[model samples]
Target chain A: MIIEGRTWLFGDKIDTDVLAPGYAMKLSPEGLAQHCLEAVDPDFAKLVKPGDIVVAGANFGLGSSREQAAISLATLGVGAVLAKSFARIFYRNAINIGLPVVAIDLTQEVAPGDILKLDLAAGTLTRLKDGYHRELQPMPPHIIDILEAGGLMAQLKQKRGL
Target chain B: MPQTLTQKIIARACGRTTVKPGEIVTVNVDLLMGQDASGPRRWRPRLEELNAKLWDPSKVVVVSDHYVPAVDAQSAEILNISRRFARDYGVKNFFDMQGISHAIMPERGLLRPGMFVAGGDSHTPTAGAFGCYAAGFGATDTTAIAITGETWTTVPETIKVQIDGALGPEITAKDVMLWLCREMGMENSFKSVEFMGSTVSAMSMSERLVMSNMAAELGAEAGIIGVDEITIEALKATGGDYEGAEAWVADPDAHYYKTVTLDVTKLGPQVAAPHAPENTDDVGAFAAVKVDQCYIGACVGAKLEDLQMAASVLRGHRVSPDTRLLVAPATVRVTEQAAADGTLATLTAAGAILLPSGCGACAGMGAGIIAEGEVCLSTTNRNFQGRMGHKDASVYLASPYTVAASAVTGHITDPRELRTSTRNAA
Candidate 1:
């Protein structure tokens, strides 16, 4: 699948609290989704449309491992997460929940609002139209299996005949 | 060709007899996990669309940690929904109001060496203290574990933290971790960190737990203090039911991506400022900052030793009239024993407000939130802006002693400075 979206660039260590702040957590996922990235960029949620990608620096998803962080992004229709690195929990949670999370090392060249296309199978993140194209280390085949099946539960259901 | 504990655990889980450094392997997991704030409820419809059933029951764990004691009716209802899901799914490893899942997992024997673990909680990596290939996942990923007992991991390159020197009295593992979080930014190593030092060898099981528990705060995929006598004793005390107790340490020549050193002598009381946990500096840096709330509880603060340290500082001295002090025990056992030992009495008599034995008020799940612009000095992990209930509220993360001393004086003050008032009252 080639995911086409606008890029929302964030620096390293963008924590869960900032992604989906705790105060907003009391609200529903949709409600919280509106405030996603409000702590960093107040206009983030209001300006973005569906199929957007969040490109971040190293250690993305750095605190609490709260699924709300991933859910907030997904509900906002963020098609995928591209980071230099991901916090272990956030990375797994994102993939399990079917949010495509990819890692590329050239975070220095990616800019916010740059339209990009991510070919999950090709391990290529190409800047659509004006963005730069960079290759990423693709997730393993089994992980692609899990992601394609729409996370762990679906993968298990297919495997165990559930 | 020595293998690191991480390599060994990953290799074993994947059925590979040996794992050389930097070789990637797919592994099966022993357990999958999630908690309330970031559970699979929103993703449930997606799972249904995908036509999935719960995976292996024995390998799944769901906890109601972030909103325990269900502060508001909404939170209570949310927890009820989670509980109903746990019951309907026949998932037996559910923990509600028991304590932080990271703290309770080891107590319940779910974390063991040579096992791979993933949780929806970032601190899920806390289980790596058991020498397991443990990491945290997001809700979507946890939904996979809830339905499947495996996760894919690129074998992480290991980083070694070798600590030495002696820990002074009042210096706890929390300080060591905070020191690491500071030295290594909250994402310092990216993945795989193992702690080995003379000081680590000298630390108790409780101390090591604290050290590994906060490893995620540094953005590590997993953190471990090499298994030794203390680990064996700790596992035994927690019910010795684990099968691979001896397989918890690394071989001597294991490869590491980077190696760091902490002398322990250079460490002191650490405090993380609001909006970020890694904004940690020496506690003394905030000596004049006023506090509106003082909280001591959560996975880190609930230890008996932590309470005793706070009690020792608060003994005979009253908390400041403007300050509110919230004391929560990490576990029921610690809560019960503290009451029996009069430690609870000493804290309460000194004007500390007692809360239940869960992760109360730490994650802003219930109570203890400060007013807008108010500042709170807390003993829990995470000081991210807007973390403590109100987006405008500010929090300073500190050690238990610093929290108590600051509470008594209504401002940040070193514990040593409070000795005069405590002695005068006596």
Candidate 2:
């Protein structure tokens, strides 16, 4: 339930349309990440390294229920998405797809390219540089159970042997 | 506890008498919906992984809508995947040539009152107009539901939106929703939204769908409308033998987290400016902004009456030389009806280009895509920074009437202004 990675900062109200632009929808699953955030950060697909973290302001993923928003990020191998807040469906999609999303006030704590650590189990986040940190509010137990099993699908498979 | 509609519906789906906000419960979905753009992407292979046939094929509805006429080999592949899933799983309600499921489901009697419907596409909330607790979920969730006919949700509190008085003759549900978002903001983001009052009861299913579909813009869990005689009669009129309709009204003492009321008589046509749906203003204040394209597409905006409104505005008039008008009907049945009623001919004579019966410009998938740096007054939902292909191609969301009126003037003109102007701008 703990992850550490480089930071990729974005602003508030990042919608799903730009998260995975509709024009790039025909691309294969992994190819979707290639266009992730290309509207705002044209070089995101070319520049993002695996296991990176994305931090943003309030109402992150504030648009459609296109799972592409979360899938594109998952395909990019993001460690977690730390935001001031999240739109409800996007929050559910992230957890259902095994992406740890925490709502916390961390916009002033870390900078882009800074290494930060997140602990979903203990509800905490720590900046690897200055060791500055804060605790996050834990998700509900049912959601935590899904995240702990690596996502809803894996959790369902494990529990029901589907 | 006094139950809101969300509590009542969720309780019924979960086999409980009552439920509360943030209570996670397993639900028995009455129907599962998947669109061509999203369904074929995952569910088929996932069902194979689970070694399962569909829990009950009769309850599944798959509509090939997003990329109709097959934009490419890839689009055809997705369409074929939907067909294969339907055929292989024995899903009885598969409609490939129907244009859009949001309109087709209700028109075909698949959507009804007192049902728990879940779909893969975001605009699936449109189905909630029939008094269903319907909302959009992802493909993975669709896979799980296909396997077990069940899903889970954390029940949300209700934000009851009441529409009082009569709507102005020029006003449409699109304006009503934009006004609500502008006034309340997305403050009701995580709550269930119910549209009620005299204005709503008088509005047709199309009008109600327009209001419910915008609920997603509020980030609502489900945009709900209570079932009344209008709902039942709309179904009966469909000629599809829709007899299962039931009345599901909120109790008189229903508990709502918040109540917001609007007198439509006092409200006029409204429009949302570029980049956000909540940043809205009256159409009368919009005059000098020239437009490159005027589009009417998506399930929310492209119904029969919407086309009729646009056609009436453009009856003998031609579209301005500088502006291009694109009409994409939400369903094939709507297109046929318009054709039968001469609405299509009127629009075509006015120089409107008709796209397939699906989401054409809404996602910038095929036709109606605009150039960079151009401004478009569109009827589709979402005016995100890069929504319609190019990030700089601005889309101003409004009702079909506002879009049509703007088309005549080649600028953002008010629909009410067209009441006097007899001729189109040259």
Candidate 3:
């Protein structure tokens, strides 16, 4: 599977509080998405287009186990996230919700709004702007299966014949 | 084969004699915990959609700490849904407004050593103080575990954190953790951190809980300390099973991805400035920073021992007229115990306003939250931006001792200075 999107840049330790602020947690998914990353980038939710890719520095989504942090981004139509690293729970949370998360340091190479293409099966990401390419370790088959089945909930529904 | 304590517990859960790191395996969960925000309020809809019932309600524990005494209609509805979920599912261990789930689980003897536990909140590793292989998961993963009674894990390589020597007076586990946040950094993902050494062994259950609790801040899968006499005795006192609990210790030759050691004899009280837990410095460095609020609350910092630490510092002193102090015990039991021991009296006499037993103000919810441009010195963990209130509010993380001392001075004062001055006067 291949994904293409414009890049949106963020910095190191972009914690869960920024991704889904605690004060806005009581809002609905759509409402919460409007406040996503509002602490750092007030225009993020409004300006972010569907199929946009978030490229961030290390330890992205570093605090809190709130799945809403990932949910807000997915709700805003973010196609995938590429960070230098991620907090373990957030990584799994994103995958469980059918959001693709990749680990690669592209903060220096890619500018905001630069279109990028991700080949999930091939484990390759190509910078459409400069034709620069980087390889990432392919996800395990079981994880891929879960992603293909549209996340863990969907996979579970399939197993139960729902 | 030698195995880390984490591996031993996971192997038991998976019905295997041994397991290796990096291998994915399905393990039966001994207990599953969740609180209002991440628990039933989110699970109910998905469970209904899947037409599923809880695999075993007896193994599930739910708490209403997050939205307790709901401040708004939305929060009230969330709490109501949590209550109805427990009733409909026949979840016997449901704890409504009983304080944080991390403190409630052990207080009720629901956790046992060697158990494979999953919680729906990040601080769930607090149970690792009892030697359980406890880790936090997202709502969806927790929902899956609720339905299946099992979950998959990619076994994590263990990072051994060894701290030797005694903590100086006024220095507590919170100080050690703040220092570790800087030493280890918050990027050790996909790893389990086991804290051990004379320092951890000598720590009370409350202090040990702090060490394991902050392992989340270190970005570890779980923060654990091997079961010892203190653990066994605490379990026995709490009416939990302690039989063979001491066998949960890690083998001496167990493989570790890395071992980080610290000698705490010379360590001073540490504090982390706002925006990140890893941004730590000695308490003295922040001495001139005045605070608007001094809060001692949350699952990690509002236990009986933590309350006692604050009370000791505030025994004959009053909170600064310039700064307000809020004290929220971790649970009803902690409050009862503190009240019985005069700890509550000492705190209140110091002009400390008592808050309800819940995750108040710590999760940027409920009461006592700061406003824009306000600053707070907090005993709770995690001072991430917008965590405890307005985005512009600055928070500094410190031990209860430091928080109480700072409350008296209206600035980030080291507890040692106050203790020394008090002793000199006495």
Candidate 4:
């Protein structure tokens, strides 16, 4: 699996409350994307375009089990979230929602708005601007299998012969 | 091979005799719960995709806890839809207006030792107090359970926490947890934490809930306490069958990567400073920090016992003129019992505003919204930026006792200083 997108850099432990505030708890998924990251970066929802990517320090997507944190990002058409590490549930939530999450060191390799190409099989990330490439942590077989089946729903449906 | 309680539960659910960390397996979920906001709204679409056949309705539960009194038309409609869906799907295990299911589920005997329960809400790991492996996931995973009654996981490594020494008369579980977060920095956010040693064995069932409820706040997958007398008593309280609960304890040689010890006797009332649960200091460390809101609720801090502790401190006193203190019981049932026991009356008399039972302000849903630049002292778990509504509003987390004492002074006052008026916790 390979994914390509422009980059958005964030700091460590960028929690869900900043990603999806409680005021939007009643809003639709699309409405949630509009307010996603509005707490930390007020222009996030309005500025994010589809196929953009999030790059962050360790412990990204921390706090809360709200799927909208991942939903809003995916809804805004984020290609992937490449972080040094991730919170347990947020990582699963992202994959279950069909959002690709890659563990990589994109901090020093690329700057804001730099395009990135991630190749899962080769375990490499290429910076289109500078052609600087780096190896990333490989996705385990189980995660890849689930992703291949198109998230949890598709996997369950396929397993159940639906 | 020896295994931790969480590992054993996962292995058993996977129908394997043994498993190790980093190995993946799909296991049938023991229980799955959701609320008005997270339940059917997301599941409806996935259910339609799966042709609407529920794998096992008995294992699934829908409850109306969020927006319980129907704050708006949308909330009211969501609650109605939850009831209708439970009826249409024959899911008999449903709750309405029960407050936080994180506390209600165990109190009602739905969670037990050795079970692997998944909830749509993030705080569901509170069930881990029963020696079960419980974690929170999104509604998409909850819907997957509806289809195949199973979810997948990579076994997480275990970290052992050895708590020793007797707690001070005024110190409580809340203090110990905040101290742990501060000292440990929430290590192993994707790992399991197993509590061992004398203090854990001596804690009451209610006390254990205080620990387990905050495990998620530490970013851990689950926190397990060895099943013992308190565990058995918890099971007996709800008339739950606990014939095999004793076996939930980890084997003698279970694998543990690290050990963090806490000497309760040496610890004092601690508070998590604003912006993060892991940011902590001695209660007196922030004596100059005044507060605008004082909250005692949420799954972690609002158990009946917690309410009793706060009421004991506020029995004949009033909150300071500048401070606003709020006491929210964890559930409707707790409300009735507290009222009968005078806990409610005491808090109300002390000018502690009693809010309805539900999870609101802890997640910034608005039962107690803070003004910009306002500071709050609370017993609720987590104090992230914007957690209590205003991003500029700060939150300080401490025990109900500390919060109650602070309510009277309108600043971060230590509970020990008011010893003449406060009752002994033990």
Ranking by lDDT: 3, 4, 2, 1
Native-structure RMSD, model 4: 2.2
Kindly report the TM-score of the first chain in candidate 1: 0.91
User: What DockQ does each prediction reach against the true complex?
Assistant: 0.54, 0.65, 0.88, 0.71
Task: List TM-score per model, in order.
Answer: 0.90, 0.96, 0.99, 0.97
Model 2, which residues run further than 4 Å from truth?
A160-162, B239-246, B423-426
What local lDDT does model 2 show for residue B94? 92
lDDT of 4 by residue, B1-426 (tens): 988888899999999978899788899898999887788777886798778667889888887777766778888888888888888888888888887888789878887788998889878878888998988888888887777788888888888999999998779989999988887785357788888888888888888888888888788989888788889888999877699889999998888877888788889899999798899999889999989989998888998999998988887778999999987788888999999998899999999898988886887874887879999999988988887888888999999999999999899888878765445532
What would the TM-score be for candidate 4 when compared with the true structure? 0.97
Candidate 1 Cα outliers beyond 4 Å, as residue runs: A3-7, A104-139, A142-162, B39-55, B242-244, B420-426
Score chain B of each candidate by TM-score. 0.93, 0.96, 0.99, 0.97
lDDT of 1 by residue, A120-155 (tens): 888888886765667778677767887899866666
lDDT of 1 at A130: 64
State the lDDT of candidate 4 residue by residue for A65-134, as single tens digits.
8888889899888889999889888899899878899877567767888998888778888888788888
lDDT of each: 0.78, 0.85, 0.93, 0.85
Q: How far out, in Å, is residue B211 in model 4? A: 0.7
- Model 3 segments more than 4 A misplaced: none
What does candidate 1's lDDT look like per residue over B31-64, in tens digits? 7777777664544665676676677777778877
Best-performing candidate as measured by TM-score = 3
